[model samples]
Target: MNINGDYHVHTAFCPHGSNDKIEAYIEQAITKGLTELSFTEHAPLPKSFSDPTPDKDSAMKWADLDQYIQTIEKVKKDYQSQLKINLGFELDYIEGYESAITSFLNDYGSVIDDSILSVHMLKTNMDDYVCVDFSVEEFARIIQLFGSVEAVYDRYYQTLEKAIVADLGPYKPNRIGHLTLIHKYQRKYAVDQGYQFTIERLLDIMKKNKLELDVNTAGLYKEECLELYPPQAIVDLASQKGIPLKPGSDSHTAKTIARGFNKLSLLTNN
Candidate 1:
């Protein structure tokens, strides 16, 4: 598995991730023989929106964006000779806040070397955003609100389709993060339909837009998912379609720098 770079990684700035410093992650990446590492901490959210998680601290403070950028820039310089460090943010795609997100990206996107555009939250009938991967209880709540698991899947994929077409100026992310993140708890609450149509639509959109797919391995380590995100079949299809696939650890801690990368290599090889 000659995985050279990891594009999706979080740091202490991300409240949901470990408190480890960027240096710790850089060291770990060096140990794993990764040539490039990108610090893609979760992008700050708007004040009007609130996450429905129990902790309510999934993202960094909006004011801290400058500090986050400065820190990563310094680290990138410090390790310029040893490893390649790219600066970016894992921006979430919320339905109604496209303009706000685009504005933010326009301001900071120029400095970003790489980024992952992800759909982590969906709007409920109540007009509030709720996390799709927070917990099984939350997922069930969403399913109940939508009247069924398939309906939730429909909404999720629909939001992703919008994300694919969103305009974030010239700095729009070139990669889609964790294409099947909504399936984090598939083992607990299975959907009857295969979602092949949705997958095909997403792939087609990516192909047309020249967007890449994040072949994230984080799902394989999750207790419920127990499979690589997008699964093997999707990867094979993307390969056939010539949609570029970029492997990401989606690391929340220094210890998880390259988790499941070997499995990804094996899967892609076969």
Candidate 2:
């Protein structure tokens, strides 16, 4: 896995991630042997988000975002010799909330390099959705109830199907994040046959629709379900289907960038 780009990254702006400056992430990526990297901080639908978000006071502080962007632009100019740093964000899914995302994106839509739409939650009121991190407790509950890889796959992909229908269009995503991360804490919960078959069907759908995916390494950070999104079988199917793939860390913290890449290589080798 010659991982070239760290497309999924977060900084202080995301509230939950490291408080390090944007330049810190760029430097770390360069040291990790990245050729390209995009800074995709959490861009939540302000109104849809909780007033006091888990990590910050509000969804996304526009002030911090502007400063972060400015820092990235300046550092890109200053370093000039490092990776091709880009500005993008993990735009949370809001059903009718596309307008909010679209409006913000419109400013940079012309020149911005990339964007990733992630459905952090399954259900929402109205069309508006905000990126909400699954609490460890909630994740544990989900796993306890639906962690069987088969159950996890069923729900996650179904949600993904809805997302593809509602969110993805015109601007096709550069890559899908943590395709099978719902199983991260519950590999034992995932059964073999049903999970595999269902994911195969989803890969077929993505292939038919011509979507690219990132082979995420974030699962390794967890104690279980150490494979990338949609699992290895899905990845193989996607490969067979001619979907382009790029390795992504889904790095929420600065230290773990590019961690556990070997696990992905093992899957690829087999």
Clashes of 1: 0
Best model per TM-score: 1
> Which candidate has the top score in lDDT?
1
lDDT of 1 by residue, 26-75 (tens): 99999999999989888998667777777797788888889999999999
lDDT of 2: 0.62
Candidate 2 residues 1-270, lDDT tens each?
A: 345677777777776566776667777777888788877777655454453234443235776766767766776677668678777777665444566666776665554566676656544223322223355555544445553435544656677765555544455455566666666656544456545666667667766666667677776656565556556666666776777676677776777676655566532321
TM-score of 1: 0.95
Query: Residue 35 of model 1: what lDDT?
Result: 95
